[model samples]
Target: MTIGELAKRSGLTQSRIRFYERIGLLTTVERRANGYRVYPPEALVILRVIAIAQSAGFSLDEIRTLLPDDRAHWDHDALTDTLRRKVADIDALALRLAQRRAQLVTLIDEIEARPDDIDCADNARRVLASLFDGD
Candidate 1:
């Protein structure tokens, strides 16, 4: 199909298709006699895969590694490894976020427990001491 038809079918702009071609993601693109880009029917499926991978937090470079012209030839080992690594990354991020939330909650509790007779500076110092003194 022509670039426009492919764009309409793939839900991607023509420039995006061309950019993918330039980036070596869409290697099946052919050139017509008039120098217009011609795409096969499978281009739409490839574009959809790219969109899905992006939604799944895969970078274009990673997607490029993950995809090939033939789906049957996909490296199951590599795909599995990458997926496992991404899960680990997400797990680490969740742990860090949890720790940060707990720290903030502790700070809020400390601030709220401050006696009304203490000034802001003294309260801050007390909070810092409690936090750093490992109590």
Candidate 2:
């Protein structure tokens, strides 16, 4: 098939396909006498895998390391290790986010609990002190 046909089948733009080829993500394609590129049917599946890996938070550089040129050369152990590491990173991020959320909630409660007669500046000082003192 032609580059246009590959783009239609893979749901990627022609320029993106060309970019992938230039970046070594896509394998070299055959060219005809007219200098137009020709792609095999398997190119569609390769493009889909690249898209899915990106959606799963894999960077293009990481994806390059993960995906071998040929399926037979795939390293199962490396794939498993990389996925496990990503999960660990995600867990650590979740913990940090939870801590930040709790801190924000505490700040909001402190503001809401401020005395009606207190001035805004004093109330702000109290909140700042509480946050710094880890109250």
Best by TM-score: 2
Measured with C-alpha atoms, the lDDT of residue 85 in candidate 1 is 84
Per-candidate TM vs. native?
Answer: 0.75, 0.85
Off by over 4 Å in 1: 8-11, 69-72
lDDT of 1 at 18: 90
Evaluated at residue 6, the lDDT of candidate 2 is 93
Question: Poorest 10 consecutive residues of model 2 by lDDT?
Answer: 65-74
lDDT of 1 by residue, 8-94 (tens): 988888999899988988877788899988888878888898898788788999898888657558788988888788778879889
Which parts of model 2 have CA positions greater than 4 angstroms off? none
Per residue, candidate 2 scores C-alpha lDDT tens digits across 21-118 of 89988884888999999998778877998898888788999878877788557798998898888788879889999999998998899998899989
TM-score, structure 2 vs. true? 0.85
